[model samples]
Target: MVEADARIRLYEPSDDKLVKFSIGKASMEGLAVANQSACFHPFTLSAWVALSCIMIQLLDWWPKPEYGLLGYLPPLPAFGCWGAVMLYLIDWFNRPQFEDASMDLLRRPDVADIAKHYQRSPSSGFFILEYSGKFVGLIAIDASKDSQSQDTLMDKKKLSSSLPAKKSQGTSSVATIRHFYIDEPYRKAGIQEDLLAHAVQHAFKADSAVKEIKATTTSLIAYSQKCIRDAGFALEKPLGKLGVYGWKLDLVVLRRAYWEKQAAGTVL
Candidate 1:
């Protein structure tokens, strides 16, 4: 449980080491989550079942009476069953997914410098949630390069504006939330939602031109949809199949006007 001392504060230079460690830890955790969340995509299961049936059908057809009621050969059916089991094991316990996911986290810039890319933009910042003296989790948001542009109506906004969108935000003064992770032990505390709320609330209030926020999460993360939904983000679209295992990236959006209209008093 998160202690009463738990609080979300601005990121400090001293926290860099722990933040890196957490990101690495999250890579391993992400792999575990990906492995367990396979149920979310049932097609994978159906395919495995179909393969097993095919293997059984082949075994029954290949064996002859002289071959001991097995395929034409004495040990052919045994070999077929063994081969099928091995394939299932190899597919189910794949390590490529973990390797790919880990390398990506290690490459992300924020795991170390906080919002270094922002170049100290006040409207953007990294936050760490601390329980007692230990860091429980962290979330960061960065404004697009067009952050300073004049406020304009949503209908009037155009991609041709002189300023390009921050890669994280990808157009206009939008702020993209990144590296939002909580240590496993502390997730049961329900503090994740509050941490997310503070980040979003701060982003909207920090700048007026920043009328919308975008976040890239994964279909592999089962709880992500509900958590971000509770925070006022709606699934805008699917990014695509991202890894070798066919996992997907989803884009979710939260509009400033919508955030202001939430009925939940506890939502920041």
Candidate 2:
């Protein structure tokens, strides 16, 4: 069984290629799946249907022979602003994902440098979940993001620091889940769930000041949101929308007090 071979451990410099392959593939696939999921929303579908009907209507405006011959297609680019509207709409939807520096940190040989971001704070770390000696998934924590949500959105600006951009300014103690991804084949085995558990424990164990752990998920990823909810995080607030589709992301917080209470009053 895949479960028998499952192991969750810290990331290593040597895992570069495997990390890149898994992260990029899974990240892109997740993005595609999430996009498809968002398109299924009633509003999105209705808008798409309306657009299609408009396009079909426009096709009738195509030049037709005096005999009303078949196969007469319109000069699409010449027709009104539909072409420009589609181009601008696609651009608007695409910019957010590519411009998001934090997301870029998740995909590459560049991502290998993630350890540098965590090294200054023992309370933070990057973790890997391996199955049968192969890297299959990963998760990261950042002490720097204590007072704010993880910077998972794309702004027009590039990455200004090795650390994520949304770190809060304060004396409060919190840890943020910076990145988390598990490949599809290994997702439901429960071993993958331990990755989150391990990360949360490590954050609390490494820093007594860390009174809470927080993560964010978009409405597009209902399964991921459900998993985080089951892990004890409660919705904190709706941050904002992303892309032309307006997928909503929310902050969720899990307090250290709950952990100690669950343990019958033991400190982390």
Candidate 3:
């Protein structure tokens, strides 16, 4: 049983290639979302063409003795503006996909950076699901403060205080699940559920102060949302059309209380 369990386990430094492939797959999905929603802008294309022509003209003139440095001046603004517009378009293409979210930790360009991130933060964890020694899926958990407002937290505190004493000690920290992905061939095999459970367990083990586990997904990704919901999370909020799901770890406190009570009884 231990040997079988070892196949699906936490990510190691040697699994860099697998981690890169998973992140690339997730990035491609984000790019696909951009491509689908992309709009045609004739003016933007025309501006780019116009700037290119001016830059070419300036370069041609710069070789002439009379033009000299004066030729360079004419193209500087055009070049700068063109570069800015190109960057804007690139960002615009990707912005709608992420909706200005903070998943940058998962979308890192370098897999080594991601590995370094997990190594630096003892409170963070990454897990992979493997079959026959080949990695097939991946997920990660990150520590963060609750995004809820102070007033909302206060309200929650008041409500919890009214509950039985065993359940009143709520935690303020949160663990967020990110970059969850499964290979196409491995889909629909219940691997994602196991990966999620492993991620949550790893998070709780890594940071006992974490009071909740949260995840966010777009409605378009029905399977992803279903996997989260099936793993005992519930919809906590709606970000436009996107859904934020969370699982409160109140049971963590209750379980500790029960264990302490048993210890006290034994002592008595």
- Candidate achieving the largest TM-score: 2
TM-score of every candidate: 0.66, 0.67, 0.50
Which residue pairs come into collision in candidate 1?
A: 62-71, 63-70, 63-71, 165-171
List the candidate numbers ranked by TM-score, top first: 2, 1, 3
lDDT of 2 by residue, 1-268 (tens): 4454777887788876776666556445545554555555676556655675576676655456763555354534443354455545655674567345335755332254665656646778888988788777888877753334333324213455555544333333877786778877667765556888888888888878889988877755555677778777888888876656666779899898887665574544
**lDDT (tens digit, per residue) of candidate 1 on 40-70:** 3466556665665676576564445664544
Q: Model 3: which ten-residue window has the lowest total lDDT?
A: 243-252
Measured over all alpha carbons after superposition, the RMSD of each candidate to the real structure, in angstroms, is 8.2, 7.0, 15.0
Error of 1 at 7 (Å): 0.6
C-alpha displacement of 78 in model 3, angstroms? 40
TM-score of 3: 0.50
lDDT of each: 0.66, 0.65, 0.56
lDDT of 3 by residue, 112-153 (tens): 355644543445667788887777888876553322222223
10 residues in a row with least lDDT, candidate 1: 147-156
- Candidate 2's displacement at residue 206, Å, is 2.4
